[model samples]
Target: MLLALDAMGGDRAPQEPCRGAVRACESLPDLEVALVGDGKRLEPLLAEVSSNVRSRLHVVHTEEYITMEDSPSVSMRRKRNSSLRLALDMVRGKEAAGCVSAGNTGAIVAGGVLVLGRIAGIDRPGLGVPILSLSRTSLLIDVGATVRCKPVNLVQFALMGSIYMRCLAGVPEPSVALLSNGEEDIKGDDVISEAREILKASSLNFVGYVEGKDVPVGKTDVVVCDGYTGNVLLKFGEGLGEGVFGLMKEEIRRSFLPKIGLAFMWPMLRQLHTRFDYEKQGGTPLLGVEGTVIKAHGRSKARAIDNALRVARQFVLQRGVETIREEVAKGGM
Candidate 1:
């Protein structure tokens, strides 16, 4: 399978994307990557790739590119030949199975909708991020795709999120929960209140509301919410994960005894760090887009880009889009 990658989309640019593509090719025997960016910039990085895996890497030239600060709507219209749009265009044209970008979230969503369009029954696409937990990861949908959504939109998000968790994560009957201030059914605002009724009547494993504190505990496999709230939660988790680790490091450096203790605890601490690492989570999928689209973090490096390709590959292999369409049709909402 061929995958389109925006080589110039992240903080590390062509270097990370190129190296990651090589790593992905090595890991997935059937995978090939199209690195979309300026050929001149990407050529040097490709040299660093091992000869055995080098044949799987190809570059698609494009000088035009979108910035992190560019308005998504404007950028979509203005930068037609941008690497991000071109990569997605490959998917639309069936030249690639999927596209991955570590760029601006809004720009990726805009380009995806404009280029690939949305699935027939999908009202709006949602950005679904996987949040790692003690037992398993939870899918947090609508992280930033649609800041303002209808009750029906939440229903669609729930259905799409559930399909993703089940198909990709192997959750046969994934539990779904609405993010709320309290566990009570009546806790959230009018949108959540109305959506709760619809989800309850649907065929999903509809668990009731889950508070912010309950999200990380992995009580539910899917956490559905408006984009405004979901994005805040996503950012909060990122900050908290890094902050806690930083505090631990500071304490470990305070004294010789604590430093010795750190050596004894290094293995467990490394495991915790790996669990909290955003790179390992890869990218968030923009569900409801006609083609597979992954929104990788802007700061992603080689490993993150590699994992994002893994995600795109799995999305295609598991038939995530088709599964969502089928589930939403049966959801009867």
Candidate 2:
């Protein structure tokens, strides 16, 4: 399968993305990547790759690119030939199966809606990220796609999140819950309360309200919330994990006994670290868009880029978009 990649999107840009494309091509035999960026910069980086891998890495040069600080609407309107825009264009034109970018989240969402259009019955596209919980990896939707959402939007997010977990994550029947201040049915604002009722009435395996504490222990397979809440929770979890690890490292360095303890506990700690690492998780899918679009972290490097491409490949291979369309249609929304 051919995938379009924004080679100039991330903090490391060109170099890391180029290396990642080569690595992805090497690992996935049937996969090909069209690196959309300045060909001059990207071509040199591919020189060391084997001929087989090099052959699969195609470069579609574009001088323009959207910056992290650029306004989403302004970027969409102005940067017509940017690497980000071109990559999405490839997907819209069917030149590539999907697109992956570690660029501006706002720009990607804006461009995805404007260029690729929304799937039938999807009011707005919700971004879903798979976060590692104690028992399982839970999918959190609307991590920054739509800040203000209606009751119907949350319900639609739950549907899409459930479909994503079932199809891509291989969950048999994903349990769904709304992220709220409390677990009581009466908790949350008007939107969440109304959404909870609607979800309970639907055919989904709705688990009612889930407090913020419930998310880390795998209380539900899918957690739904407005983008504002979801984004704050996602960032806080990331920061907390890093702060905890940093403290542990500092404590280990301060005393000899802790150093010896670290030697004994290194394997388990490393495993836990990997579980929470964003690099390993790669990109999050922008669900409800017309095509498969994986949004990698803006600070992503080579390994993260490689995994993000793999994610896009899996979404296409699993026929995720088609399944979502079918499921949403069945809901009569």
The most accurate candidate by lDDT is 2
Candidate 2 residue lDDT tens string, 90-159: 9999999999999888999999999999999999999998878779989989899988899999999999
Residue runs of model 1 more than 4 Å from their true location after superposition: none
Per-residue lDDT tens digits for candidate 1, residues 145-212, read 88878998998899888888887688888999999899987699999989999999988899989998
Residue 193 local lDDT, model 2 = 95
What residue pairs clash in candidate 1, if any at all?
A: none
Q: Can you list the residue pairs that collide in candidate 2?
A: none
Per-model lDDT = 0.87, 0.90
